[model samples]
Target: MRKTSVLIRSIFTETLELINISDVVSKSIRCDGSELIVCGRRYDLREIKHFVIVAAGKAATPMHDAVVAELERSPHVWMNVTALLISPTAPRHERANVTFFPGAHPTPNEVSREAAESTLSYLSKVDGHTFVMFLMSGGASSMLEAPIDPNISISETAEFYGALVASGLSITEMNVLRKHFSLVKGGRLAVAASRAAAQCTLIVSDVPSHSSDSVGSGPSLPDSSTVQDSISLFEGLQDRVLLPESVISFFNGPLLTETPKQTDKAFARSFHRVILSSTELAEAATRLAKASGFHVEVDSTCDEWECRDAVKYLLDRTEALARIHPRVCLISVGEVLVQVHGRSGKGGRNQHFVLSCAMELRQRHSHITVLSAGSDGIDGNSPAAGAIADWTTFERARLMGIDAQSCLDTFDSFLVFKELGDAIMTGPTGNNLRDIRILMSDHEEHAIYHEF
Candidate 1:
């Protein structure tokens, strides 16, 4: 058990190191005096009279710092450099030229509105000689916002988001709905930066497919979704979630506008690159597992699966793999959905996943250890990032007189794991790339080795 725990920790640490915001940004973007090179594109910085950085998301501060460091390395091209950063947390740097706005996440608030207005205000000042650099990541949809209609209050927006969260829809579906209602999402930011000489967007993708337009609702990239798609998605909720009347009306009203598309002139000078993705994290974990003398099997992206089905599928595969290989590690990446019915309790999808697996593992008396976590180090509303479970997790719950199924049904896996000391906590990891699930099994492992 100790060796297995150490191996899991090593894999997790290695994955985080590979997706470090500072390292990703520094490696993907560089400014060399006259030319600014990012993901293979080159822009002559010498001709630009002004260079502005607009960044928002979980890793906004670190990403901004990396860009600033690269810019400072080329002092000749550092003239007129300014920045506007929006994040769920406070600024990490105290740069006079960089304005920081701390916004709400998982849901938008007045601060989110303020940040959106501030960003637009800065973009409004850009001229033909300005070069704009946009940095975006997972939480941007909630951290930055500018609604197209004035009648839609922040509370209405919050209610809309709440509905989406409870709708059991994928992130892509929710983001598609989000892009239609905002003024600065779905390529609107690119439209706002149209006056700039050139624009570039660097993305740290949290979406399953690393869709450039879906990350942060694709503020600086073309949106392929339409108003009809958003309406259909909301309608498919089938009364499982409730939306504010204003929100319902907005979707039904004539005020709905399609987001900027590929044909828009705003993209003429815009270049987008997804610098980091969840697949990279999965690959990093695979490498670590192989180095530890375990046979690694990576599952395809499981973005569309519900929490229950995803856990079942991975566990079934792990069991089969363990029979053939003495040591096996199965990795799966992507966000899973959890349908919250009635009064749902505290716990995110990852915790729910781990709890569900624990139930099955205990029933089968399997000697497998599973760890599920959000790469961003935050799982839902709980303080814990996620949870770890083994064959004995259910036994521990039974001994404590805790009903595991009851917890799973009520969406209260957080409490179950907390009581068992199986919760994985790593305060906000400054980066987001979706979630990762690691399942390990050893053919000769016994009951004694299953105890954490």
Candidate 2:
């Protein structure tokens, strides 16, 4: 059991290396002479005299630094180069011509609104000679904001977001509401900079790769989700806790506005590339698993699935594979939805997922190991990134007098996992590509199998 724990942790940590911010940026973007190349789209910087960079979300700081490294190494001269980074943390260090603005996450605050205000103002001033590079990742949805209705105060805006979180809706459904509520989301960010020479968006995608525009609420991409869509989703909210009346009223009132669409002029010069995503994360996990002598399979179809359903499906797949091979590893990348009930406990979707697996794996007598963790290195309200569990985890918790079901019932997987020393702690890896779940097993002595 101890060796299984060690092996899964090793695989998870190594898997995160390939998707780091520096590597993602360097591989997807570069500058040669007077040309800036990103995702194979080249911009001749000789004619474009100004360059504007806006890096936001969890990876904002490192993404900014990596892009600056490229810019600094270049000998090409520009009339002016300005950069702004909006992140959940305070500035780590100051760089010339770069301004760092601190913002909130999982919720919005005054700083978030101010950051959005500054960004809209700055981009609105850029001329046709300026080429904008928007480096976006996961947390930008809350790290940058401006409400469409001035009557909706910052508190109201934050409360609205909190309501969406507790609503148990998928991220896409939640962002539908966010896009209609914010001034900068749903392609409005690109519209504000419509006058710029050209703009390109490079995403370290936490959302599904097929819906990369959903990252950070599609700040640069055209939004297909509409205000009517938000109203419909909002109308169906089962847990409307902390939902503001003003937000609700505004959506139903005259102030409601539709998001920018494919026909919008703002997207005419816009371009995008998904630099990193679950696909990359799954590939890395597969390579590591194969090198470790396991028959590996990848299934991301469970993405955006409810946690329990996702666990059952993945575990079932692993069991079938383990029957055919001496050693098996099933790799899954993407987030599972966790719907909170009543007041929540300290845990994220990943921890909740591992705890769920422990319940199913209890008394199974199999050498199976499961790991689910965020690449960003944080999970929900807890400090631990995620956790690991195996066949022994349940009895181990029971021996320690920790009730797995009760903890899970209260959304408190973090407490049980921490007490059992199963929590994976990696502080702020400064990257976001969503979550990864690795399920693997071995046929060994004292490892007989049974099904739930």
Candidate 3:
């Protein structure tokens, strides 16, 4: 009989492989001579005079490297062709043709503001026949910002993000508000690039449904959010004093235009936005489980499912199976949101969920391995994409002088997992599928005690 814990670990491994950066990057990229294809169309670099590459989000480094490899000759690209990376560890500036800036994610910082301003400056020089390649991935919202309101600083924007995160808003909803508050978002970049030789956007989707407009707030696509929607997104947090006066003025004033109903018609003429990567990794993960000789089942749940509900469903199902056979593995995908309340701790949704699941599994000795990770290699507001936990994870914490209860109570999964050494780190995987959770049976428990 197959060990339940091994089977569960296999499932988790499969899921990670499905969304592996190499797989996603390979699938999205194709090169033929001087023509490089991103989404579908082919662009001949030889035909274009100036090539400017702009990348934002966690996937920047991979995307940048991919673009650089496609160039036939180093001289074929111009020194003016700059690369902007939102994440901290972007590609280095070895070649004069390329420039790199490390920005922030989830929240804006001084460096992010500078990067956004630099991006806008690059836009000013774009003209007809200027080849503009846009690389977008998760976390571009804050990294690609250009202040619509001059008085608003990075501090205010960061503060707003902090509050929004605490309020437990969806990425799409938060981006809707962000688009109204910035000039670079909502396809404005597309509009600018429309004046270029040809604009192509390569997106590694983090959104569950792969909505082009929602990912990175649709820098190269039409934005469907309005100011009214932004106000509503704030809800009770509207008067919380988290936002700056300039931000307040922009929100309250008439300057914040509703995002375009669709991509600018000019965008259709000048640009092509392609979704190169997404939850396909989930399918890969599914296949990996089956190939490993485990009876595998994939639940294609809607991304809109709540995290708590999803966790509950997993727990309930796992428990039921334990009651019956006690040797089943469940794999889950899609991002989950966590609403922060009072003196919260430091951890992303994946961490929080794992912490919660660990707490439940602590007493039952279910031997679960709740492995939640972002495909792009970073979870919300944290460096580690996600974490892994088994029944012993809690006990291990106790042994290490860490209290799981207090950590969860403070909503700090990062610290909890860090102490327990269960944090999953992959850097930037160049792929995104939101989060993956794998519930396993302890391998030792099945091998040593439960021989069928």
Q: Which lDDT values do the candidates have, in the order given?
A: 0.85, 0.85, 0.69
lDDT, candidate 1, 258-295, per-residue tens: 88999999889888888888878998999989998899
Tens digits of per-residue lDDT for model 3 on 411-439? 77899887766777677665555677766
Question: What C-alpha root-mean-square deviation, in Å, does candidate 1 show against the real structure?
Answer: 1.8
Which runs of model 1 end up more than 4 angstroms from their true locations?
Answer: 447-452
The lDDT of model 2 is 0.85
Compared with the true structure, model 2 gives a TM-score of 0.95
RMSD of each: 1.8, 2.2, 3.8
So what's the TM-score on candidate 3? 0.86
> Who is ahead in lDDT, 2 or 3?
2
Tens-digit lDDT string for candidate 2 (210-276): 7877999989999978777888887788344556778868878887888899898888888988877
